[model samples]
Target: MSEVPGPSKRFSTDNSSFSGAKKPRKTVLDSCTSDENDCSSEEAVYSQCNDGRMDGPFGEIPDHLLINTIETPSVSLLRSSAITPTVSEQSFILPSHIGVAGYSSISALPSFDDNNRQVAQNIDDQPSHEGATATWASTGSMKTLDFTKAQELLVPVPSDPLEAFLLFLNNDILDLIVRETNLNAERVLQQPGVTDKYRITNWKELTREECMTFLGLLLHTGTIRLNRLNDYWKTHWLFNIPSFRQYMSRNRFMLILRCLHFSSDPRDEDRLTEIRPIVDNFNTVMNNIYSPGKQLTLDESMVLWRGRLLFRQYIKNKRHKYGVKFYVLAEPEGIVLKFQIYGGAHEETSGQGHTQKIVLKLLEDNLDSGHSVYMDNFYNSYDLAVKLLDRQTYCTGTLRKNREGNPVDLSTVTLKKGEYKSVFLNNVHIGKWRDKRYVLYISTEHDNEMMEVTNKRGQVLLKPSAIVHYDNFMSGVDLQDQMLSYYPCERKTMRWYKKLFIHVLQMSVANAYYLYNKFSTKQRLNLYDFRLSILEKLLPKKTDQLKVLKVEHKLTKIENVKLREKKERRGIRTIKEIVRKECKGCKQIKKRVATLYECKGCDGSPGFCTQCFCNFHS
Candidate 1:
């Protein structure tokens, strides 16, 4: 048995490059010191080894290629064998791996020859099953799918990010929120054994404008992170955001956050009942506003939530491995086209495989338009490619070679780096290429051709066109996930649906920004600046010192003694300005009641509601 020299042994600049004995663990390519080489023999070795490789992707073939290839779909699939190495192959071994540096090993070539032979014949002769089976053609042209759908914006795209965002969160949605919020507050106050802070007199009905301001504060807090919500309204100038103190009182903000309800229905049977309003409304407006372009991508994304959830998923590869999972379909550049929540196994699929159902459902409206979808191996299959073609959609992605309907001999034919094997029948093309490792792909579009691409190091390289196109279009969901992750509005909460609701709001913000860029002709704004613009627009009419926190106003012993002696001159009076605050009188007895009037001749200008004031002053 001949030894296969590891990577380092085959490319050593030192001519006595037979250092295989010295470096026991290193590969043939590792021993080479330089990133480049002028080795002529190595070039000949690559050319000789990579002969008759497939050109692009799926190509022309007869209909019989995909027949069960066996008796049952559930039957044990064939495992392609290690191609018996030829005499010349055994002799001409270069352990060094090819990289983007343009085949740098400068070494003498060992003698070998299989130039006149066809690898397709070898692939065909090797039987994967007992019966005669299909095999790769080794050489063929591909038919890459062109993205033909140029979408028109369904509505006039707004130039302002805030207006674009408002298209989804319009007056109707805001009004519903206001009504429910107010109703829920009243209901909470009426509950048995309710605390004094939540009493009917202490609760003020929330207005639509106030709701917008509340959301603005939430969005702003997402960007300027702090340890606690109270920190934003702190009295100290060093840490306080004056706008927070002036626009909304701290207790009021907490009140809104606590009682922020989307639906009035108190049913626990439907887990999604609480947040269904926002999710349903946002999903509708998202697709109605803008149409996506030719290329699309489908994948799952996770929202970072480690708390208790009925349907939370743990995906080891995801950035937020433990969270609620969402199946997302989006354009290649990060615009969310459609999304569905994974509510559990019951809601996962209708009647098909999980992959097929998700892809079909997400593309339900976008299909039959000649658009191409790029996916990873998890969702790629020969069955899926064929199913998509039936709907006039082209599917391109890496496939699991062992998946049912794959060619019998593909595994049998081993490929070195830069080499590929492919067989086609009609529109479906299945192929495996060797790069850093083995890669299997199935595609309905994309012809067999090499594409010139540049690496980050600015080096030019040639890759299969299918591989290049897949790399270009497959990160849509990931990109959307990345943008949403930038300024997440979600916070710690006991309700999983609330966190989910906040996450959907964050998605709307992202979609709004994408729309702003897509339509507005003027100076484009980044996400942070765009969100800032929206926040400013959504802020309620400002007031002069609504809830000023006087942290240093703690009384000394003398002041504390005087605080008990309320003079007759101090009186309950209505101030010209209408502001909501915790009543000073209510606070005296450890209660929290909102007041609309202020007390005259008071040291701190504390507020007092009608009933609470007369009770305190009397």
Candidate 2:
């Protein structure tokens, strides 16, 4: 193999001009002075052999290419490889390894043919390649830099509403629901019903589609009051035109009654364990279905349930004084991006305080730069603000007066009604104002400024931008709650977990409606109309109406006798038997007809002479 040159050889700058007549000289070489291992590499050295040939790892370097340099040999060799042919007149080889600045690879160099000498001369006249090697020499440290770390952040949006909606209610969840329903149905049928006539029997297992349609009907039906599913199934009243059985049979509906969770072990401590997969699976789907916008809000939403449960909560101020509480993060359009069920103190997260921890957990996947979050006083704190700010996120919310790290000046400052003041400190802005009451707000995004606002009476007033934006944006979760409550599928259930399942089901439907409006090609539909459409699709095909009977032709002799027998069983006399048909004869008056019955055979008819019948009988 040909040997590469060592470091001692040097090319003199005095002979700057290249001449074909002069024998090609050895490349310049400098000994490795530093202890760094970079200098010991093959490309680092150029030396002369006994035959006067320059050799190192690089066998034969041309003399015209050698530039006299007193600097490090290794860096110069790498920088030399980055040079490109100026005019593209001919082709030359460049090392596959080294890069040009941050560009991936070097372009092809010009070949040294007589036909390309003019092209090379023209290229040398141009200034584009000036100090190209020097630039690369200065950037030696950047060769190992990872370009992938600078990737742009991307958020996903769903193109199809139906597809996105069905993701949360996947086959796995439906299968589990079916299995649990069967288990409960078996248990229910084994026990007697409220009445002997109403005892359940031969309950069949529900198919996945049937169960889904049943849910759709429940959502579409609004509210109903009936003694049993059989009543809804069989009732033929005008008001119940499309009977509940049109969507799902009574037996199938009864199989899943009050049974969302199933456990093989009857004595399992956590009855909710069986249905926990649903919660996890649904949350995952919803999280990945659509990415939230830059603005988000965090607050608590209640799933109404007045039941005896270990995690059941009661908030006096809420419309529902008793229910399960869920901490939710939502977009301004009332879409729930993420949520966590509060299972008492045991549900505590690993972080600061409960409220701050909940806020952090809700905003975990949404901590991108410039993303703004709004919340109530329960979650706003200085520590949370700082932490979010560090992650390049901005947070704004109402702040409690007693919170730690609040500005002392904010607390001491007193203002009259309709007056406000604000202070900026450490990227956090604190605003204080008094209207009917004192309001304090903390934010990282807003400045201490007020904007003119027109009230309902058309009176103009000045409101702080922070307060205005907070009011407008902080209601995301509240808006979601309101939307959910409008066509709510919540039913009174003693089983807390079942109520939760129902709550999530309603949420999924509402979300689907929202997404449909967002992406649908047809006219947008409201929540009620959307649910009705889904119900229509899910319901069984309508059959032809049965023929009706006329009143006069409906009752024949046999039918009349049957009606009489039915009525007589309760001690009621029939009209046909009550009318007197014959009369018995009186004394002197000629042929007097008795108004009462004289004989059994003659009195059976409606018209008969009592005197004639009595005389004839005698």
Candidate 3:
């Protein structure tokens, strides 16, 4: 019910290549149609030449009938005529098969007259051992269509989804989090049992590379139980990486993770709202990159989340029935173009209904004349179809008979199996077909025509073209859901925002990888290979020197509080307990520096040389 906007300027077509070619002038074509020997004229129309016998018009035995309407400069006379015959004596004959039953074969069809015989030679010259075929036989090799050029002209190449993903988490966001966390450093360090000086307050702004490494670790390392952090630190290869340890510590990671701020204030309602920035940043990047084709599908998907939430949905049929609901618009290839997070009871709707509004919003920026949108019965209605038609967009969707504004006569029609009826009301084509169950469909594009479809059992059934196209294209969002589930990135999270974040991240990765395959000039990487590439980029292999270290040495160092304090730096006149306990400094000769100091200000006053203590403390 919203005012539909014009087609997106970002998705505007580049028709310069097509429009640049001037329309073929009629005069040029008229020049070729002369009256000499009609067979000698370029525009001579003829029927089948029966084994080199002229049966059709003008008594001219010219070659093939099919003509190249475009691209070819000259009209090709399939076969040349030795002599011109009178118009009254001319007769036309349809091509006939000599041997085969139902099949048409052009093989061994005779060539044209002597002057231009080779021009009309059949595509396949080998004699058919079966029935002699005709009518639909290939005349000659048709010029191949170059699909690469066509695709380039028609479809805009999608931007890398990975780049978009990283763009959303750019350096500005990292610096913002660091700046905010540093403001609350005192409170973080004052927490109970906070003994490590290098813990919470040592926050630093993360580089893009470091942030990438952090996300890589989060994605690569399955999940760690918070209670068993030390266990993972000791055994997990990812946690033991020297570079990772040097850049961040476990406690620091958690502290900063919790302290991340997208806005200036946590208590400000507008500032702390979590989903806003994420959704905006993601949608901005997604919309600017890929443009949807004329055919689009609208459907619902679930981001599986079992945690407590007000907007979580539980559909009886969905695989993950209980999760965050998303209304998605996608192309036939399952590339997501736009999406809306369902707010459940809080959603605003117009008189057209929630489903209708969802569709309109998804297509608000894509209301071009040639665009066709397909949906299931849930979002289909006579009024909705008319609305889309008014915007110069086409709509095709299955309908419910009992829905408001449906044609009463079509819905009431009694038809046996494999039967269908179609009727038009105000430019809306309504069709009712009986398959396993009777189905009603409304379309602005298709007529009531039926097409023969062969099932797996080889049974031919007539189905409406509307139904066939709906079945083919109405699964875009569902296909996207399936692809995302194949290598699911969802993990257990207590925060609903975190659950949503990970879901969006997974979507971004899948979309990026899908587009990469579609547009890449090099050998395309499959989903598995694409993911592997991301893993390698995020967490590169360790250096050989680090790889050779003992597992125990690689693990997080256990802090000996007593020995640590003993090595504390002394003031100018500070007193020290010079302990002879293994010298604590030298192994070769028991050389103990008198500079070992103990201070009451620190816990567990263990002795330490001034130099060792200074290096250890800070």
Candidate 4:
């Protein structure tokens, strides 16, 4: 797998704005003793207040929700006081409505103390809410996790890295880019102030080969970087990529980059119309190249573009906080299977929330194929997980403790650093384990069991089976982002669409590298080597020199033909069978030659062999 940042240091969940100052996450959370207030209806060690009152320890509750379920002791009560609570900006509201068969009014509720277990979250994470417990009502029956579909590569991958890369950005896409680039040039020339012919005279229509070479040069800059763009073509020994000049001149490269276009007839009202071709083509090839394995991850990738435009987002949880947000469905090992560009607030449809709609939309093709998806709190919900389960898909992810549809025992309960609470309902196993902080996990794939995971410091930590699986598969997109950062192809551009194209180009190259490593039986090259090889193929030095030599030879032959023709027009030159001197070129090698042609325009008009006749001409 590609290198990615450890979860311990990653940014927060995808979306959250701090209402107050953000505090540093503690490396080692303060440990706590076992809870003394351990009695609950579900029989876990959930802590209570200093006084005796049945209350929700994890989140705020509404009186109506509590008053309706007065007879239910486990309605919103903590299952254990020893379980640390998950920090959440969202407040958990108890769901309303329950049968009041045992009792009627709120006065019959049990009394508790004021001594409450330490809420693992700061007040900033979870807003304060207090009331009675709500009933842990059932939602639906748990269906069996029965998935038996097999995924195979529809097309064969070639051994060549360039070929593999082309699988994603094939010739059709390149041709499209070429056509649009030329179209863009025509469109620009048709505009005012273009007849000056300063940059226009040098502008020629783009070609597929040159277009790919432009991408190659873009990738090359990442490898041999300089402080400035013009440095690559400098004549000085200190700042010259000599081979770069062999493929394209600096002026030509910049001109192509300026005129680069992706689509025709773009719609201004449509946010993605300008770059729709690239996005659509890349997605199609991504799906056609290889079908993903059983385990997939759903997440967001932030392409850094701090420009002014609509739908530009600030995800505090992402390292690149301000940029275009992409909802990506990728494999566990950093293969982007599908992606959706966030257009604006309207990207999220009405009825369903933004997170649910995006997740479902990105996973449309892979749904019900027995793929197990892992996600963070940004997308994972009890309702979504149950919904995926109903579709024969499995999902496991860390949830906000207060997310709606959470089991009351798992959602409202507070536990110490080592305790946990788990309940299975509708095949969705919602488990809250206290390990430094509350880890609320909702899963349709894993059971309510424990698993061991090694931490960054090589220490063993016991986590739920779902949490372990989440840790294992949750970083597919992050892996892609991290690998991309090492040698990025992005440069500062005024056009936001240009930035998007460069970002997608980088993703395609990364995808190509993954396929190369996956299929090549030879000793696999690292990303740098793989990228360098692709660069060499796209802009080769060997053929450039040969082309130079061939052009020189052809130019000389044509120049002589023109000179001979000019002399004939003047009637100043004539070919005669004279006592021919041996050819100068052949005589040098001591080979005798009797030429039928004589040199022209020289004072002597010296007799020479056919090959040496042009050498003696004035």
Ordered from best to worst lDDT, the candidate numbers read 1, 4, 2, 3
Put down candidate 2 lDDT per residue, 1-618, tens digits, no spaces. Answer: 234444443433454444555443333232333343223443433433334444233344444333334322233323321222243312222345632222212211223444323123232121222122112110111011111212121233334544545667778777877777777766766775444454355455677877777776666545454434455665334235445655566665654564445444453444356456666776787666665567778888888776577778888877787888888888778887788887765444733367777887777776754578888888886667767777778888898876655554566788999998776544667678898999999887877678888889999989888888888888877787787777655556436766677778778877777766775566787776776666666564555422221112111111121223335656866454333322323423355443433343322332335444444444
Instruction: Tell how far residue 226 is off in model 2, in angstroms.
Output: 6.9
Highest lDDT: give the candidate number: 1
Tens-place lDDT digits, model 4, residues 1-618? 112233322322433422233322211111222263323222222222222333332233332322212133332332212122343323332234432222221222333334422222222232112211223333433456555766556788567878887787787988898999998888887877766756855788788878888988888888886767788888554674667787789999888988888888757667788888889998898877787789999888898888787889899989999999888888888988888888885433424466777878788888878888998988876657767776789888888765545544555678988677777654667777898787887787777667777888999977778777788789999999999899876777638888888888888888888877876677788988888788877877665465543432110111122223236555867453334454545676688875555444332344455555544331
Worst 10 residues of 3 by lDDT: 129-138
Model 1 lDDT, residue 97, Cα: 61
Candidate number that wins on lDDT, 3 or 4: 4
Estimate candidate 3's alpha-carbon lDDT, on a 0 to 1 scale: 0.56
Give residue 49's error in model 2 in angstroms: 74
The C-alpha local distance difference test score for the whole of candidate 4 amounts to 0.66
**Candidate 2 residue 270 C-alpha distance from true site, Å:** 7.0
lDDT of 2 at 243: 53
Per-prediction TM-score to the true structure, in the order listed: 0.66, 0.60, 0.58, 0.67
Off by over 4 Å in 1: 1-148, 197-201, 264-270, 348-352, 540-618
